[model samples]
Target: MQLPGTTLLVIDDDAAIRERVANSLEESGFNVLQAGLAADGLALLGRQRPDLVLCDLQIADMSGFELLRQITELDPDMPVIVSSAAGSMGDVVEALRLGASDYLIKPADAPVIEHAVRRSLDRASLRLENQRIRERLERVNRELELHLKELKDDQAAGRQVQLNMLPASPWNSGEYRLEHRIIPSLYLSGDFVDYFRVSDTQLGFYLADVSGHGASSAFVTVLLKFMTTRLMYEQRKQDVAGPVAFKPSDVLGHINRSLIACKLGKHVTMLGGVIDEAAQTLTYSIGGHLPLPVLFAEGEARYLQGKGRPVGLFDDASYEDHTIDLPPRFSLTLCSDGVLDCLEGTTLREKEQRLPTRVAEAGGEMRRFMERLGLDPSRPMPDDISVLVLSRNPA
Candidate 1:
């Protein structure tokens, strides 16, 4: 309705008519541009975006109908009004067919001209607004696509980092063979296993499960690796270079205190052990871990017991170490809670009882055991699953 900032182009061979129309439209708040020929008007239309165009029928180079056809070709939605002194009905009909919005006679009143200009300008404004909206939507779609690509890249990087932190191969210490398996539910895992040589005769290992998945779990696992690696190095130097040997209970207690000091909201469920080849023994502790390890000897299986709370839970929690003398060609297997999910039955203890039988028959093949448990490594697990199998070859 209001033409403020609405641009209008006036084209007429008669300089006086063009000036009169431009002046009136400019005074009425429209931004008016004028041209004396049809060619000049079309050139201006291509260069400057105008809301409406008013053209005289007869021009030196071309007719108003020809200019209207060109304008429609360039932008069909742009409005055009035709004016002429001839006032012939045939010319008016031809102008309308050529896409002119209205036909006006020479010396038309200011009010009538203004009303026609306003209506035509309104149509042009609607067209331009719709065009702008379409462009904005296209830009938004492209941005969303880029954001999704970034997220996928981040996930891949996290998975690579997490995998690099794990042990590349199984550990063998003459008296013990340690093999571990882990399956993550996502690109990053919450489950982790660690092995480090404390001495030529002693080795330390642990399997831990953090609280959640993705970056949070990956971060926690990284911290665990650093702490455990450092602890093993320190303990080895303390024992090999000195007279005293570090006990499993003391190690567990120290880890618990350090985790509480970190003050991370999540806690870790873990089983840790120290194997001494010379003594043919293992000293171990459990921090609220599920499925107590299955010990195999003499072609039979049994469960070893340990006492402790999950790490990061309490600062003063005491741990009790359990000692086991290794028998010739014996095996011990430790697993996370996901093992229980593999069972068809209701309770974890019930499922654990069957694990030893499965391992004994499979000759302690960790992968076979997992398969027999109905775990599909190809599919995403509901929770992190880690398995650590340790065995002593017969002397």
Candidate 2:
């Protein structure tokens, strides 16, 4: 919007040239200010902040070069057009170096002079707009960085809380030992384990790997712990003669129903068990758990036999319970499938061969087994890796 009050100050000592330029500018809707001397022009500039200026190179009192310099110091962004004659080429170039935005020929046409003024003002407006956009982009980038840092900090705090909820490792009592170690690929793990006494002579333990990873899968692990802990508590309150309540199959069925009810769209592969030290028996169930549980004793190790569909998949899915008479002294090792990916094997059979042999060599110690596999807890893993070991130390 070019308003009538838009001002242009013309400083040309020639009476005729100054009046002609001022008349052309006034016709173009600009308020015109005429000055025949540099001092008068400088005074007008201080009195009025014109949008542009037209200066003749040979103005009197002060040189046009001096006036250009003073104009730049007053307002560097203001556009300036210098009018010069043929012999003043050198002075015109020097004026440009002194900050004139454009140049006009001495006998300048009205149209051309008006065009130069408008073009210079447009360039100045574009520069200001570009600077504003760059500053705005920088501010947005800084805000995004701050938001990302907050999310990372929250995840770290959540990871620590999950770790604190896990049962302590290398736990020992009477003739039984139970312990576990887990390394998560992310801040939180989908793998979980628990071991606790279910009766005077019965010890219960289980290892589970929830589907998926991170927060959603970790939520299922918490559910697994809660359901199992509650089942054990309720069972202990009932008659001991009643069919052992936490039998492997019953535990799997209960978990299957609860997870399906929760509608989390997630499933779990697990090995749940009850060890009867008095009867020398280990009754267990498997819900699609892999690499099966391996039993190592004396000088040998082999995978336990058990089978069933993964829990939380189907409402009618049933588990077949299996029982083995445990030797007087044995080490049972449970591993999540993530560990198999770390083995340097071309076939599943070869990786399976590595697991038991390594267990027998470690003599049921979690540390020794992990060391043999070159596992580092501090380093990030491709997937979550977990190990649960139940052993009876040699007397």
Best by TM-score: 2
lDDT of each: 0.81, 0.87
| lDDT score, candidate 2 | 0.87
Model 1: per-residue Cα lDDT over 47-126, one tens digit each: 99788888888888986677788989997888999988899999988988989888899889888899998877777777
What CA root-mean-square deviation does each model show from the true structure?
5.5, 4.8
| Candidate 2 lDDT over residue span 1-395, tens digit each | 35666788899999998898888878888888988898888889988988889898777787778889999999898889988786467876898899999988879898898899888878877877887898998898899889878877877876787777688787886798998989999888999998887877788899999999898898888888889988887887785664356788999999999999999999999998998877879999999999899999878988998789999998999998899998878899999998898776999888988888888888878889998788899989999999999998658
Error of 1 at 315 (Å): 3.1
Model 2: residues with Cα > 4 Å off, grouped in runs:
1-133, 240-244, 347-349
For candidate 1, the lDDT comes to 0.81
Extract clashing residue pairs from model 2: none
